[model samples]
Target: MTTSSPPHDLLPLAGDFDPRTRQDWTALVADVLNKRRAEGDRLAPDAAAEALVTALDGGLGTEGLYLREDRPLGVPGAMPFTRGRVVRDGTVPWDVRQLHDDPDAARTRAAVLDDLEHGVTSVWVHVGEDGLAATDLATVLADVHLDLAPVVVSSTTDQPGAARALLDVVGDRPTAGGNLGLDPVGAALRTGTTPDLGPLAELVREAGAHDGWRAVTVDARVLHDAGASEVDALAVAVATGIAYLRHLEAAGIDPVDAFGHVEFRVSATADQFLTAAVLRALRRVWARVGEALGVAETDRGARTHAVTSLRMATREDPFVNVLRGTLATFGASIGDADAITVLPHDTVAGLPERFSRRLARNTQILLAAESNVGRVTDPGGGSWYLESLTDEVAEHVWTRFQEVERAGGVLAALEAGLLREWVDTAVAERDRLVATRQRPITGVSTFPNLADTAAERRPRVALTTTDAAFAPRRDAAAFEALRDRARTLERAAVTVRTIGAQRDFGARQGFVANLLAAGGIATTDDTTATAVLASSRAQYGEHGRAAVEELRAAGAERVLVAGRAAELGDAADLVDGEVFDGMDVAAFLGDLLDRLGAPAEGDPR
Candidate 1:
């Protein structure tokens, strides 16, 4: 005979542990804070609570804890719809949109069919520069059922022609959904060309007679790819949308009708919380824009397509991207995104294989089916933390949007190079964090898997960044550069000259070894090495300095210190540089490579 416990009481679970209150938690945190703070500069109760605040761009930030007072409420399918656009009662959650960019027409056709046959709801094909050509659209979509599987096309150099080509294929197909992908502004930003909305306006007007097709997709992903903050993306997307609205209006299309024609494609990063908040904010602010333009409240909700971040993909340990994609998809699902696309894990290295593409689409399927992540409506609505963050993001976005309008909107800002400045600033801060390892890019900057082998793929057409066009970038490029150089150069003889026993020097020795491994270099204990790094702040400080100097005098070409160089006092001049947390690892490794003849005598920088 078994006894059932109380259904919702704490007594059963708290059999041994004592119950704790907010005060108890605060007190414990206070103890830790006081220990870390300087003596006599201790934080008071109020300041202690705020000490864990995390700063974000545009003065938006998050605190360690949010309280009841911070809560702001909203319902699903309501005006200023921060919760969601629709209230679902066990309905299909979101569209699983997968991207295909293979240049081969036959391969793309096979992949597109495979994706649609196995849980994928929509196809996002990239046409032009390095992607499928315009002539190949017919072949790629030959077997795809236009009524069942929606196809959206994006292009850089082959814009209006590509849009027309897709339309020709769709012809008079009933229930054909998806976009013509005539994002003139986005194409201009990507290809450094002047935007002409005449074709887009014409498409929107002509497609109005049809049932399920949109004209333009105002892709805000360009902003994120170019290293803009969420605030920048929100502001710029609004500005671009309005710009399109006015252009379409000038060409005799109503604002309300134009609203239905444009869709937004935004970036969803691995930071799930921030990603959710930003997406919510995008919906909220876009609703306000529609209201300002005299559109009905119900039609104001922005249709958003969330694509998992391309910038977060790593080249070396590509497997880590599985987790990244999963987190991004979770964020998009909870954030009430209409559709999502997950770029394959090995995307940064080259073209993704069939296995990579399968994993990408299945990521969304597992979350939707097994996890039931989308069963709940507005999962973040009740949480004080998410609500506060959403409000903050929305407010900041409005401020920036107003600023952009004052500067004559998105086109003018691009012309004035103001958008470039914003992207540059955000990129600088992001780069600084990665350089210092404060951001800690797993498998690249921190805890890297040195023995992992790179998966080889066919050579892909390289994408580039310029002052005129927003471009894609990877954070691991710096460390990867070091690794590339190390691969080409002769392996260095790196020895750790330990000053103390295991208890003292072991930690620093391990740290030094890890740092070397990041550059694809190894370490040894051989005293007669090309380079030696003195490890530990052993009790025999002077003796340690003398030993390093002796090694350098005997035959060592380069000598570095595991600890701070200043710690050696008079012998500081003998050491080359210091290796420690927050040090410029790139510059250190680059200089070392130069010393080791990395360029191999003839290659130009």
Candidate 2:
């Protein structure tokens, strides 16, 4: 059939579409039609394609590429746990669990009471070699209202003594809800001895065979707190749980009945998204496990216990850890964890001071009461970014879980060093970031007032073993010499100082300059030679930048920046350029000098 020209073809178009001058190339009919024409021939080069080719050839150096591909994210609450389990009916925030790890029963009891008074709804009594004993269980549970509160206990073994003691304390109290952790996988990981899974399975069967008690599959907080990523932590946890379930099933317990008694104790880190995503992904994977065992999907969810991670806490900035714990608490709660325990901010320093404990309890209280963080379920739902991140994390974890399974499940993975290697890689990356200050820690890395710490306070008990346990015990003089060396180095370090009303800005810049100087630059060693600039304005800008440039010109490889908020913007730029994002500043400077044909360092020409 013959076709007539369109009315638009009869009129002249106005805008230019030429490569040289086109305002909108999309309107060019030839270019648009040429796409189809070129389909049978060859494709034309574009900036993106050229860039990709150049990158591939190592010409125009770039980091990576984006390829659009879709992978299956199992339905929410489905197998392999790609998305999440438990589509929220509404926001039913996770239970609040505070830890009572005191070796002394009376002290632990006091801590438990204190936790209860501060809006804590659950208590986790740790009974490791360093934790409380079964003998202390009674006093720990005494006077605490049991109707609504739940307690969880962890030990190195599923020894009958620990379980019998715990069960005896909670006997006949309608509200006496708690789990005696029988995590053989975790026990094995910590103690270097594989547990007799037969006893563990029997314990599970016994717990499930009864009522108001549980034998949990404890993953423990050690993995995450020891530097494992969310993906590794959750994957290992799921694998461990599955390993337990298999053992139980083989022991003639129903598969569905097997998982019903297990509980997970995971670490809650400062990475909020990661923590939340780990829980969500865990639920999904667990649901699949339940399905594999012929359990109804609706009844597949397991109780999750979260504890504040010790790995990220710093002995230097003890109080600032309060903020990290708060974030972790909120993340764990929102992640639908059944319970959460926020470690005292100063717990890393040994014992938590009363003030530190108060701060720790207050953090959770503020999140739950004042912030009302517990009122919403899946609070992160429907967010494109969070959802996408949740998917990515779930997929990553699922892949890792499969790898673990292929290696004969979680315990086998650990035994074969797969899990340790995974954790070590992540730990190395995190340590590198911390060392470089790419991830700035507020009080510890940035500020220095090491001697300004308050009076010492001991914790009810130490959860972590000291270096003395691993290393040979040193005599008093040897220890003193080590301390003296540290003190000497601290005194020899460069310090930056910026003057003027712009105190905060200058302080931050000085912080960055000092960090650089510590990294090998020969800046002024005097505390006064630290980068310091005086400015009238309350903001940071070119004046600050110019000051930094002048400092650099004056052989001040590291200069402290000081300024007000007005000067902060400029100081931030300088730090960002010289320290944080500027990984190749030295090379760039050398290139500039070479381009100018300036004499190289130590050149005699």
On lDDT, the candidate that comes out on top is 1
Model 2 C-alpha lDDT per residue in residues 72-164, reported as the tens digit of each score: 544544454333344533343556677666677887788888878867777778775667788878988796887777777777533555676
lDDT for each candidate structure: 0.80, 0.60
**Number of clashes found in candidate 1:** 0
| Alpha-carbon runs more than 4 Å astray in model 2 | 1-92, 157-160, 447-455, 459-485, 488-509, 512-605
**Compared with the true structure, what per-residue lDDT tens digits does model 1 show for residues 395-477?**
99999898888888888888888888888999999888777777778887777777774789876775543557777767777
User: Each model's TM-score, in the order given?
Assistant: 0.92, 0.68
Candidate 1 runs further than 4 Å off: 1-28, 36-38, 70-72, 89-91, 463-467, 549-555, 564-571, 598-605
Cα distance off (Å), candidate 2, residue 527: 8.4
lDDT measured at residue 101 in model 1 versus the true structure, 0 to 100: 89
